[model samples]
Target: MSLDLAWRLLKGGGRKGLLSTWLTLGAVAVSTALLLFAVAVNFAFTARGERGAWRNPVPAASGAVAVEAARFDYVGDKEITVVDLAALKGDAPAPPGLPRFPAPGEVWLSPALAELAGELPADQLAGRYPDPKGVLGDEALVHPGELVAVVGHKADSPVMTAARSQDWIVGKGPVEVASLAGTPSEDSEAYRALTLVASVLMVVPLLVFGGAAARLTVARRDQRLAALRLIGATPGQVVRMTVAEAVIVALAGALLGAAVYAAAAPLLAGIAIGGGPWFVSDVLPGPLVLAVVLVAVPLLVGLSAVAGLRRVVVSPLGVAKRETPPAMRFVRVLALLAALAVFPLLSRGSSVGIVAVALGLAFLCVNLAGPWVVGLIGRVTAGTARKPARLLAGRRLVDDPRAAWRTVSGVALTGFVAGFLGLLSPSAFGDGQESAQLRIAAPVEQAEAVAGQARDRLREAGVTATVRVSKEERGQNRLVAVALGSHAGTPTVDRARTALAGLVPGHTPTTQADDQRFGLQLLADVRVGTIVVLSVSFLVAVASSGITAMSSILDRRQTYGLLRLAGTPLEVLDRARRAETLIPLSVMGGGAILTGVFCALPFMAGGVSTAGLVTLVTCVVAGFAGVIGAGALSRPLLRSVTADPAPRPD
Candidate 1:
C-alpha cells in the first residue's frame, strides 16, 4: 500500500518530478561510473605486482615450498625488482605466480613498458637500459616499462652477484630465479597518497552534485509530505514514503551508471597504466565491486533525500509557511583563509603525504567557503542595483543565497582545481632534464648497511628519494663501493649522513636539477590521471549546475509572468534571470580561484607560478563569459514566461 502511494506521488509530480528524477539518476550514474572506473584503474596499476604464492624449490627437500619474495630497491639511474628462478625442473615446480621466464639474454616487459618500448625512440631506451634488446612478455611480474626484466643467469652469476650486494636488496644471497613474480612493485607510498588526492578531486563534486540532485524540488516534496502528515499519516509513514521515492530514483541511477561503466570500460582498456595499455579484462572490477556499488549508491542518495527532508520531518507545518532559510555562515570564509595560511609550509616539495593532505584540505575548504561568498555577492548586487531586473535578481539571491550558490558550485570547484593545478603544473619542473649521482666511499661489506641507513633516514626526513646501486663491479668491488642517487637537497643529504653515522661508514652527497626530471616522470603519469578525473568531474559539475538553473527558471515561471503583466518590461525579466545567474557565479567563482591559489601558494617553489596565474586569468575570463552566455540562454525562457501573462495551471 505504501509502495502504491509512493509511486502515485512520484507520478503526480508530473513534469517537475520527471525532471528531478532524471537529474538525480544522472548524478548518481556519473558518480558511480567515475568511482567504478577509478577502482578498476587503481586495480590495474596496484595489482600488477601482487603474486599469489610461490616458494624456493632448491631448498625444497621434503617440505612445502615457500612463496618467492621480490622487492624494489635502488631507484636512481635504474631501479628494478629482482626475482629468483631456482626451480629449473630440479628443486620444485615453477614459481606459483611466474608470468613467464626470459632466456639468459632476454628480458620481459610489463604492459606499460612494452607500450613505451613501442612508442619511445631507441635512444631513450638506450639511456634507460644499456642493451635494451631481448624483450619478452610477462603479466604478473613487472610495473610497466623496464622495471621487472628477468635474467637467466644462475644463482651465482656475476649479474645476480652484483644485484644481491646492493644496499636495497632484501635477500642475503642470489638464488636461482625460476620466474619473475609481479607482486610488490611501484606506486610508492607517495603514489597512494596521490591516488587519495585524485579521488578527492573527482569524488567531492560528485557528492555535492548527487546530494543537490537528490533534493531537487525540496519545496514541492516538503509541501506534499506535509499535506500527507496533516491527513493523519504518521511522520514515520511520510518518511518512509519519501525514502521509498529516493530509493527508486537512486536505484535507477545506479543501474544506469553501471551500464555506462560497462560500455566505457573497453574504451579505457587501452589507457596505459604503468608502462603499457592495460588489457580490457583488467579495466572492469569483479562481482564484489559491482555488488558494493549497487548497494552503496542508492543508500547515499536516500540519505541525501532524508537530510533534505529534515525540515519537513521536524515541523510539517513549516512547509506551508515558506520560512526564510538561515543565513549562510560567514565562518566558511575562514576555511579558505586557514588553508592559505598553512600552504606556505609545503615549500620544498619534500613531503608527499603533507603535499597530498594539504592540497586535499585546500580543495575542501574552498568549497565550504563558497556559499558565504555567494551571499556577499547577493548583498552587494542588491544594494547597488539601479535597474529593476538587476534589483529583482539581487533580491532573489539575497533571499536564498544557498540556492544561488548551489546553481554554480560545480564551476566554483572547477575554478579552484584550476588554481591548484596552475601551482603544481608539470611545466614547473622545467625541462625535467636534471640528473643526480651518489658516490659512496665505504667498503663493499658496509655498502648495503650504508644504503639501508640512507633510505631509512631519508624516510624520516619525509622524502620519497630512491637510491641506486651500480650494475658494474668496477668501482664498488673493493673498499670504495659506489651507490648512485639523484636529486637530494643539502638538508636531505645532511640528515641521511647523520642517521648513517654509527650504523654504516660512507659519505655520498649530490643534488642535481635533472633529478627533478625523474620526479616529473612520476608526476607526469599522475598528472594524466588527475586530468582525466578532473575533466569528468568538471563535466558533471557543469551539467548539474545547468540543471539547477533551468529548474529555478521553470519553478518561477508564474512569478516572472505576473511581474511582466503588472508593469515590468520583458527585457527586465530577462535581465533579472541573467543577473541572478551571473552575480553569484562571478562572486563564488572568483572566491574559488583565490582560495585555490592561496592553498597552492605554499607548495609552489616561488610565490607566483605561471601556470597558476594563467589559470586564474582563464577562470576570470571564463566566469565572465559564462555569465554572458547564461544571460543569453535565459532570455528565451523570459520571453516564453511573459508570452502568456495569465497564470497557467499545472
Candidate 2:
C-alpha cells in the first residue's frame, strides 16, 4: 500500500516535479560514475603491481629453484627493465608470461622492447642482449608499452652472483627464488600510494555530490510531507514514502552510473600514469564493487532524504508557516579549524591509510563549515545591502542557509581541490639533454682494461668520446666516465653506452641526464594528473550548480508567484538569486581554498612554485566563471516559474 501511494505521489507531481526527479537521478548518476572512476585507480594500480611482481623476486629460504637479478637499463630517453634469470634445476617453474623455464642464452623481450630493438641499430640498442627468442606475454608486463626483457643464463653466470647487486637499488640483487611470485617494488608501491591519495581528493567531492542529490527539491518535498503530516499521516509512513521515492530514483541513477562507468573505462584507460597508460582490464571495477556502489548510493540518498525531515516530523506547523529557523552557531567552524590544525602535525612518514583518512576528514570538514560561513556572509550582505535584490537575497540566505550552501557547495569544494593540487609544483629537474657524459662503475682491478675497451668500442661505433677513470674512495669500485664530444646526440649516447655495456658484468652505463629522467617523468605525470583531476572536479561543480539552480526554481515557484503578485519585479528576484549564490560562494569558496592551502602546507616544505601559483589563480577565475554561467542558465527557469503569478492546485 505504501509503494502504491509512493508511485501515485510520484506520478501526481506535475511536469516541474518530474523535472526535479530527473535532475536528482542525473545528479546521482554523475556522482556514481565519478565515484566508480575514483575507486578504479586503487584497483588498477594494484593489478599493475601484481602483474609486475615477478620482477621483484623474493629470496627463497632454502629450497631455491632459480636465481634472479633485475636492473633498469636506458635506451636513449626510455628506461628498460632488465631481469636476468638462471634456473637451479631443469624443473624450475617458468616465470609469468613464459611458456617454460628459459634455457641458457635464451632471451625474451616485451613487444615494445622488441619493436624498439628492431627500430634501432644492433650495436646501439640490441647488442647488449642476445636476440629475443620470443616476446613476453601480457601477464609479464605492467602496461602494453612497457619496455622489459628477460634473459636466461647458467647458474654459474656472474650476472646471477650476489656480487652483481647494488644495495641502493631495490630488487637488484640476485635472489634464489622458490617461485617467481613476489611483492610490488618500491616504485610500484609509490605509484599505488599516489593513486590512493588522488582518489581521496576525488572521492570526497563525489560523495558530497551524491548526498546532495537526495535534497534536490527539498522545499517541494517538505511541503508535500507537511501536508501529509497535517492530514493524519504517521511520521513513520511519511518517512517510508520519502525513502521509497528517494531510493527508487537513486537506485535507477546508480545503475545508470555503473553503466556509464563501464562504457568510459576504455577511454579512461588512455590516461597515462606511472610512465604508461593502464590496461583497460586493470581499470575495471569488478562486479562486486559495482554492486556495492549501486546498493550504497541508494541507501545514502534515502537516508539523506529522511534526515532533512526533522522539522516536518517534529513540527509540521513551523514548516507550513515557513518560519525562519535559528541561525547557525559559530562552533561549526571549529571542525574545519581542528582538521587543518591536525593535518600538518601528522608526519609525512605516517602510513598511507592514516594520511588518506586525515585528508578525507579535512575534506569533509570543509563541507561542515560551509553552511555556517554562508549564513554569516548572508547576514553581512543583508546588513550592508543598498538594493532590494541584495536585501532579498540576504534574507533568503538567513532563512535557509543549508539551501544556500547546497547551491554553492559544489564550487566551494572545488576550491578546496584547486588550492590543494594547484600549489603542488613538481620539482624542476632541468631538461635531460644538457650532459653528454656517461658514467659506469667498474671494479678497480679492471678500470684500465675497461677504459681501453671503452675507447675501442666508441671508436669502432663511430662515436667520439674521451674515457677517464676515477675513484672517490680507496676501496670503492672505479668510475669509468665517457665524456662524449659536443656533436654527440641521443644515438651517439646510446652507442657509447651500448659499446661499454659488458665492460662491467652487472652495471649499466648511465648519464646524469638518465638519472634525472625518473624525477622528470614523475613530476610531469603529477602536472598532467592535476589537470585531469581539476577538470573533472570543475565539471562536477558546474553541473551541480546548474542542476541545483534550476531545481531551486522549482522549489520556490509558489513564493516567487506570491512575490510577483505583490508587485515584486522579476528582475529583482533574478538578481537576488544570483546574489544569494555568488555572495556565499565567494565567502565559502575562498575559505575552502584557504583551508586546502593550509592542509597543503606540510607537503610544501620545498616552497611554492610559479606553476602552482598560476594554477590557483586559474582555479579562482574558472570557479567563479563556472558558477556565474550556471546561474545564468537558470535565469530562464526563474522567468518561467514566475510567468503567471497565480497559485494553482497540485
Q: Candidate 1 residues 1-650, lDDT tens each?
A: 67779988777777656765676677778778877876666565454434312211132234422223343322333444444342244344433323334334444444444454455443333222334344444444433344553334343334344432243233323443333332242333345556666666666777677767676656567777877886788877887897899888888888998999999887887665444455566668889988997888788778878877766767777665767667777778877788677776667555666766766677677667776777778888889988888889888888777677777787888777766665665455555442333444345665566566667765765555565454434245322222324554433443443333323311223233322434556656655664676566566656666667665766566677778779888877776877787777767777777677666665565456564466557655655555455446656655765688887653
Candidate 2 collision pairs = none
Per-residue lDDT, model 2, residue 495, is: 84
- State candidate 2's TM-score: 0.97
Q: What lDDT would candidate 2 get against the real structure? A: 0.86
Q: What is the C-alpha local distance difference test score of candidate 1?
A: 0.59
Candidate 1, residue 225: CA error in Å?
A: 2.9
Which portions of model 1 miss their true places by more than 4 Å?
51-89, 92-138, 141-149, 163-183, 230-232, 314-318, 329-368, 426-517, 606-609, 615-643, 648-650
- Alpha carbon lDDT at 166, candidate 1: 43
CA lDDT scores, all candidates in order = 0.59, 0.86
